[model samples]
Target: MSFLFLAVIFTIFTIFTYFKRVFQYWNKKQLPNLQPQIPFGNCPNFAKGKENLGVELAHLYAQIKKEGWKHSGIYIFAFPTYMPVHLDNIKNVVENDFEHFCDRMVGGNPKTEPLHAHLLNLKGTQWRDMRTKLRPSFTAGKTKMMFDIIKQCQDCLVKKVENLGSVEVVELCKNFTTDVIGSCAFGLDCKSMENEISPFKIYGRRALPTTTLSRLKLTFFSNFPRLGSFLNIRTIDKDVHDFFMNLAHEVIEYREKNGNTRHDFIQSLIEIKKSGSLTVEDIAAQTFVFFLAGFETSALLMTWTLYELAKNLEIQERLRDEICDVLEKFDGKISYQSLQEMKYFDQVMNETMRKFPPVPFVNRVCTKDYKMPNEDTIIEKGTAVVIPILGIHRDADYYPDPEKFDPGRFSEENKKKMHSCAYIPFGKGPRSCIGMRLGLLQAKVGLCGLVRNFRFTLNEKTPDVMGLNPGSLFSSPVEEIWLNVEKCL
Candidate 1:
């Protein structure tokens, strides 16, 4: 018993010594940084599920801003991380000096988690090559080709919402986006709008790294990759992996056998696969990412926009008027041309992204030792750098009355006054979101469909001050946003 007790004591002491050294990293480098706590470091709030990672980082950024530091250090568990508080540093990291911070420091064993090999998680030359190849798939011409699919999904959304009198908009938008991404990305009729319990929806919810155990696993993999590799951690749940793999394979096989093809993302991957450049796993991983990103990101954006519009009746009325006028110009049809012409709608969407960006933070890892621009401090290689979009967006300096929902902030004259880096809803630079165009198109279509056809008012059930779900990586309400919807047509 004494030997066992001594062993435990020695193990704990060793861990303590290691973390002590790790936490001293920024201090040794003489960089401005927040002091870290033991074990959890500066992330005890996130670890305890008291706040989401984004909110936690935003609070840290606020502290750094209050101190008037351009940037500050934070610790993700035992790993030393950098948080850029000033817009110039953020621009340097994400844009001007992007080469030094090219990698995102996120990935799993592609052999074990094939779906983890998608563009979002890929690193180095593989990422560059894959991004280049997939570029054409989301080009303006391709988005136009996919507009019809979105139109059909919008029709379904309108039909459903017409009957939904006072319902949760998140669920409604989730269904609409699932069907839209399903048809456009996979040529599958997910029928999420028609069915309450769609399998795609079920798997989609499970696919997000939102649960406590999943978040813990992700944190471990991100901070201590070798340890994660030793344990062979997967980025996806097993069932989600199997579901997408089988679905992609079945579709690819059918397309090959029947020589049937469609103008969709899956068809683009099929053509690549035929050239012997990508494997079945590659196709599955790419399509899975398409489905997951397409559905959730746009759904959350639309839901939040609706929530904001519901709270501000004047803004909703003006937006609806603009949408209606533009649709009239295009013969009451929601077309690519009509959607683009709705300038006010565009501004509203921009402001929505500003206030509640789907990705509240952008993360990258330093690949080479980088000197802090014009400073003697050297950000060592392998350090994680985070840019808190939420903090910058809500900064009173950037946007006057940051808490208020005002689309006029994005007006042509107003946008010119702000620095380019001040607003990065889709991120900025070579490694920015590749599917941003498609995401915007999807969001515009869904929002236009609902706001033009239905009048939405905030239900009493929703809290006046929206609370966020602590577990979600993407921004989500603590609970459903129920809205009272009445058909306007």
Candidate 2:
């Protein structure tokens, strides 16, 4: 009798396990995603690199559009994610119902990591408050205060390359930018350009996890963030965390005691602290992000820009002429006004960003459950929204001859003629990058200075095309992007 009872219990457990997935649902009244299985969902096969995120999402978007759906559903693990297939829906999701999708899904626990609640993780009210406080830090007038500081870093960058005497590697660009950002962001004179393993480079390299498994786990956490509470995923490593936190505190304290007002990002954060609106952790997190977040992105942008200019000498010489012309007016200093007037240089950067956006995709979570704007579909709460940025930018419909490196696509008139939402290198909407203006300014100056002083050529070791290196979640060149540099006439 006991055996019979046990058999019955086993049967019930099996039935319940099988049927519970029936409760796992989507509004099939509208466009449903390609059906997912018991657990892994649409992306399970992606682990062994069966596909990259951008390729998979772009394929789904194309299928949904072809099927006449304005929006569609997909899955990350067992959870549903809304894949916007129409431009109107894209505008609404990123702009109109923005409050419902303000959070960037990639958040860390502020309790454990008070420094983790920088702009990227701050949700709703917290994000709004911080955004309001930080906006003035990047204003044109405010950025101008740091113009001399930028030139100082630029000089250091040129000296490092000149000393190298035609080095072939592009990681050197990253090392240089790390030094520039280290000095600019935290008032710490990071001599990374002078020394390959400079403290900044050592910590920064360690901060970015160096394994494919770690990258996949980080993405999984972002997709199913609730599970992240139980996992050890972090936006930054511990030593990196300690280094910046202590540095921020010291910098803030020193500035306060000395009455030193440098009019930098940290200065604004100090004011927020004085007003009792932000915590010590908040300031540290923002500053840390300013280094980690902005540093690598700017590095890759400059690296690719240099690579493209090397491949296209006509474009490079034209850009050099403009830089010289503009600097001739400013007594050879790459000033804020001069940087702004670099129209061709700006186009080259824009075209480069379109070719390779550092963060290939943008993710958002549905705060409140949302319905498709003009459809019967309803994307439940806890759904991930993937704006496949690089995919969209590379779409042939949006950009004819998308493979060609054409800076004219971003020419003032040509840019106006295209769809406003089609190109968003910095992203679109309120949750967009707050440090964008500063980043672009730095990128323009860095590229212009190099183009004006040197001519770049693809080195013998460089690949025909940049292969997508596995384990890099960021859009990066697979091999060393080696370029030959010669001092210009």
Candidate 3:
């Protein structure tokens, strides 16, 4: 009995000592930091779904900013993190001194899950080379070729909501985007809008960790990437992996055998493969990421834009007028040129992204020791650097009356006056989202289709005060945004 008791005491003492040393990281560096609690550190109990990581970071950002710090230190489970609070510091990290912070802090085991080798997870030279190869695929010309597919999906979305009195816009938007990305990236008719249980839709939800077990797995893999990789942890489920991989193989084989070519992302990958630079698994991984990013981020952007427009009826009407006028110029068709000409539409979308960026925070790992400009602080290599995007977007100093959704803030004159790095919905520098143009086009096409055809009003089913989904890693609403819809006469 005494021996067991002594062992327990020794274990407790060891753990306490380790935690104490870990918690002193910021103080040793002489940086401002929030007090950390045991196990969870400064962050909330994210594993238990107590808070959204993005929202929690935004709160921390606000706290540190109020204290007048240009940069601050934080902890994610005893891991020391550097957060840039000022625009200049943020700029330096993402753009000015980018070479020292090129790789994202994404965690996954590519050997266990080949699909994890996509651009989002690659590091150093691999990422740069892959990025160079894929850059042309998202060029304006390439994106324009995929516009027809987006338009077709938008037409389906219009039909889906034609006479509905009330609709959950979030689900409706997701269905629209799924079909768009499915056709463009996978070269398959997902039929998500027509069929609720489409395989693409079902598997897409499975890819994002929403459940308790899945979330736990993500947390473990992300915080302890090296250990997770050593243990061969698989974040992507076997069924989901098989579904996408099989689909990719079939598509690639059909295209190669029949000399079939389509103006889509898959075709671009096929061309890249012909150069002996990419393998079947590489193609699958790239397409999977394209599909995931193209669908979810665009869908959420459309949903939030619709929700905001519903609340601000005057803004909705004005945007509709602009859409109608631009389409009229093209004989009632939404061409790429027409979409670009809708200046107010751009403002509205920018404001929406500002107010609710889909990815609320972005992270980078320091590749070499970085010294803060005009400061003695040395950010050691391998340290995690976080840019609290949501916090910066809502910062009152950068954006006056930050809570109020005003599209005018993005007007030509207004935008020029604001700090260049102050607004980075798609991020900045070479490592920013490669598919930004495609994603924006998708959202714009969907918005023009819906706004010109239907009038939306916020249904009481949606909460008055929107809250982020605690279980989701992305910035998503706590509940489905239900909106009453009526065809515009």
- Which candidate has the top score in lDDT? 3
**Positional deviation of residue 83's Cα in model 2 after best superposition, in angstroms:** 1.5
- The CA lDDT of each predicted structure is 0.87, 0.75, 0.90
Pick by lDDT: 1 or 3, better one: 3
**Each candidate: RMSD to true structure?**
1.6, 3.8, 1.4
What would you estimate as the lDDT of candidate 3? 0.90
Clashes per candidate, residues 3 or more apart or on different chains: 0, 0, 0
lDDT string for model 2 (209-261, tens) is 45775576566667656767666566566677788788888998899899987
Over the stretch 30-108, how does candidate 3's per-residue lDDT look in tens digits? 9988898877788856645788888889998999988888889999887899999899999999999999999887657
State the TM-score for model 3: 0.97
Rank by lDDT (best first): 3, 1, 2
> How many clashing pairs in candidate 2?
0
Candidate 1 Cα errors over 4 Å, as ranges: 1-15
| Best-to-worst TM-score order | 3, 1, 2
In model 2, which regions exceed 4 Å deviation?
1-29, 35-40, 50-52, 66-68, 163-165, 230-235
